[model samples]
Target: MSAFVAEPTTALEIESIGNGTGLWLPPEVRDEVERVQSGTSAAELTAGVVELRNLIGGSADLFHAAMLALMCGTMVEHGAEPGAAIDATLDLLVATLNTLAEDPDEMARAASRLSIPAAMTMLARSKETRKRWRARPEIMDRLEALEDADLAPFWLREVFTLHDDAPLLVLDPNNRRAFEFRLIGVRDRLYHCYALLQDALLRHTGPGYLGAEPVDPLAVRYARNDHLTPADYRAATTLGDHQRFAFAYPGIAFMPGSGTPAELPTVDGVPLLTVSPKTIHFNWRPANMYGVIHEALGSSIDLIRELSPADAEALLSRCALP
Candidate 1:
């Protein structure tokens, strides 16, 4: 959960990011540009996933810290204040990386079993507040503010994009020709976009730079409801709006829930609001959005935010990870 500010942040309408151009990559990242220019087959994609993970796995610690900002970025999409969202990121990492890499679901379930700080549980039980996995904006500003944060595949302009008008690709301009990031913007394209972004990021940068990528707007498919477990269903029903099962309660459960702003079962953790079982269900749900798309409008995350944590490791692994 980010901070549960008494007042919600104004939803800024971010029409665009990048200066009609993208951030610069060392000319060395050209291999990724070449990779994008060449198309990928399903087999290549599968193999690529395995390959990238092995590369990133080399620099685990820095990767973990860099990932912290990313983890919180989605929390904002989950309708959390920037503060609460960041706090939740730290809490989710409390379990060792081994626990997370092996079985995030089990780790989450176990964390859920821990009593939410007294205030959060009290508010949740009393129907005073609940957290929801909806989208919001201030997190972008928070992102730009992360000066000391590590570098990764993430781009603030891309993440801030809310419509088709926003810049679609973080291009590599060389030889007076633009190497664009391309993808077929289908409603259900899966998390591989993130993997590619990870590739782009870590590829030239290496795991040392948080890894980089092959080019093209890549996407993957998921098994039906693979993100939903029996535990997820139970938690969703228990904490989310019973009437709208698809509408996940994002962020921590102690805030305003998904109801309305006037609602008030809000609670904060040691420094901010914490992650709850409700949150585990949200993250486990396959609702993460790709940063780039052919058409932002009418695509999967046009109006709402979809926070995905995909990387080659996630693509290669079949485990339930958030």
Candidate 2:
């Protein structure tokens, strides 16, 4: 229901596979990787349901080897530097593959199909790699110009105050510029990947129970004068709250051999999006990436423009998580 944009989820491609260097992928693994990398978006993974089953039932060594090969190849193709950037990416790939290897179908149903916390942590590490790049005076000038141009709408507002009122994870205005850009990139990547994974689950399982890994719930609060009843509070914490609600259209029906009967339907309470975190409460869908970001990072672009590259870098260095 939220408006958002997304990029394609690019699958990593491996050129060679082996236990050691100069090794080549076995015939079966090579075919699978090639088929997957060619055009199959992760969202379209359902199309490969047969292939997934085959891989799962096949030799574990072959599957792991193929995945590692793809990852290593993708790294080489991108010419990714051998530091934190490449390392973090490989780690995520490893974790994803390992989870899949353990139980392909179960994990396939998971929201994000990997880990959100790990992604945030890796995002912080990736930001660190850009420290020197953000310190450049030209980049700082660019940051200032961006604030003046793209963020003109927010120029009159106080940066921190605005951020405090919003759900976005934003850098302090005094932080470095590169970190903000990296954060944006990482956010986009996370959203796209998760969407692909969620889509895959939907396609494979249809409109049934698609279980998700638990995540932090967005704290939705009501304001004064917004009437709240005990039922509303109870419903908010219960699984029943996941149901979508809307105003009913009034209508009347004529009764046979009798006068017209007026139908009055009484609707109770206001509609709100709610979710219970962890199994202690109830089973409900996790918030989609767009919803999470929409709640957390509203007007984040405007806020980022206020930050100097130096200030952004410093802020990132101090944070353990994004």
Candidate 3:
């Protein structure tokens, strides 16, 4: 479904999401839009985009991030928000993103749908930020203004980016650049149900947050080598203000950050919280689930030997998975 009318119920995450302090705005977009839009007449700007589109022979995803952003801006001007397109889709995207097994690139189409909604949220934030800047002249110099006084900058900045080497945008108006990172969707939003597990994993680490080592032998076998050891993401902030979204990965539905969903799969003695990452994504093996075993077993993780055989079985059981 493109966007849902009935919203699914979900439990709340424990600690509210945290963010690294920085400008939410992506600068490349801001600069390029400012360059093209300023000085150049509006007609010239549209002509340039049309020229660029003709030059770029192909685009992988169904939509263009820049155009989608522009469309969002246009909608705002008409006094409407993307509405359910955002509210319903955003929740589904976030949950899908949390899965352990999903293709990032395949998620492109779904991710593209989120552009307008996400843009609206950003526009609202931008307006408040701008309001503050106007009220206090002392801080105006420190602020980064995307557009002169219009809402277009908030949406178009990321689309009309200038980076030649950045892997994310994949926007090659001229066909000279080599392909790099091929995201299923725009960097900020979830593309498919599997939007950002690795992204979800990156956040839910460190002492209390907890990440597993794919300790299950079957799980270890299926996991990609790249994911086993966490990479030091120089730019973890790509999700932008969306970072506040709870546990954006798949497999484990109930994170300490996000509490348990009301409906769970087969529970022999306890609540099934974790799903076998390998099985769910592949859809070939027996659907296996783990109970809220980590806490039930008395400690975080001491040893498998310590648990009785029956207790272990109860900890992990076959069940329906998302």
Candidate 4:
């Protein structure tokens, strides 16, 4: 006996003669993808996503269905190897869903595992900020305690008055550290970040983009907490401009600005428009997705780019989508 169940055919379902143990799709999803890709209007894409969420309605299968539909739908549009990408993404989703079904605690456990590196990266990104953060012994204590406990993603709101659980990234109209604040909004942005990352790896920066020099995948790790100093923050602009790359943290993604060394300017660099943070000055879209690829694989693109085909496959195998 199979676990597959069939619901009445909606615009999304195709006529099936018998049971197929795979994901189901809603019609609106494919419609919106085609619309958006055809330049019908990017806003239509949001409507499609909304429909998927509506369908989710708290069921795991529905959630997987929506994700699968979106993953395959989007990959078909931009992927270099759509079939392989779809299979990989679907497998990851199925494995995760199975874990969730068996143990609901798994999501939190996974989130906890991701929390330390993410928290450390945020704390270490800028010198002035790091000093302020370090002076707060209470905050430091919490981070230290995280070594023994799973990282509670919501804990960020305690230290930063700016943090919130809002799904979309919002800039503080009054705060100067607005960009930094957006990074803490991982409550709703985390999974979306993963989705965007998957899309980029399969379509934009994968094997097709391999360069003459093979890159090492292991070189990508969480930015070291004690490594970045005031000097690094000052010189960061030069570094960012020289490479023209963006960096992805837990919930936020940003581009390096070109300007005075002391004053590091930033632009929104996340590829997905829905989750992109809006500063008072501008809204960002997917100008470059390579940074996300770097963040997702927990390795730098330069390093991954340097690997031969076989080595690259081996490196990608090590990536943990969870």
What lDDT does each candidate get? 0.26, 0.27, 0.26, 0.29
Q: What is the lDDT of residue 116 in candidate 1?
A: 21
Give the per-residue lDDT digits (tens) of candidate 1, residues 161-252: 32221112221111111112322222222232232233333333334321122222212122112234455445434231111111112233
lDDT of 2: 0.27
The prediction achieving the highest TM-score against the true structure is: 4
Ranking of all candidate structures by their TM-score, best first: 4, 2, 1, 3
Query: Each candidate's TM vs. the true structure?
Result: 0.19, 0.20, 0.17, 0.22
lDDT, candidate 3, 1-322, per-residue tens: 1111012211111011112231122366445545543424445444433332332223223233323333333333333332312323223323323321233332332333344344434333232322222223222221123134331224333221111111221111121111112221121222111122333332333222222232222222122112221221222212111111232122443233222222223243222223122221211111111111011011011111223444434333322111
The better candidate by lDDT, 1 or 4, is: 4
- lDDT per residue for candidate 2 within 221-243, as digits (tens), equals 21110243455345445311121
Which residue runs does candidate 1 get wrong by more than 4 Å? 1-20, 59-322
| Candidate 4 per-residue C-alpha lDDT over 1-322 given as tens digits, one digit per residue, 9 for 90 to 100 | 0011123233233312113333343456446545534523334443433333333323344333334344334433332222322333333333433434345453323422322233333332222333343325444344344434433333332232221221222122111111111122111222223222223333333442222122222111111111334554444333321111222322434433221111222223322211122232321222121122112112111112223445434322332111
RMSD in angstroms, all models?
25.9, 24.0, 24.0, 21.0
What lDDT is reached at residue 71 by model 1?
A: 28
* Residue 147, candidate 4: C-alpha displacement in angstroms: 13
- When summed lDDT is taken over every stretch of 10 residues in candidate 1, the lowest stretch is 240-249
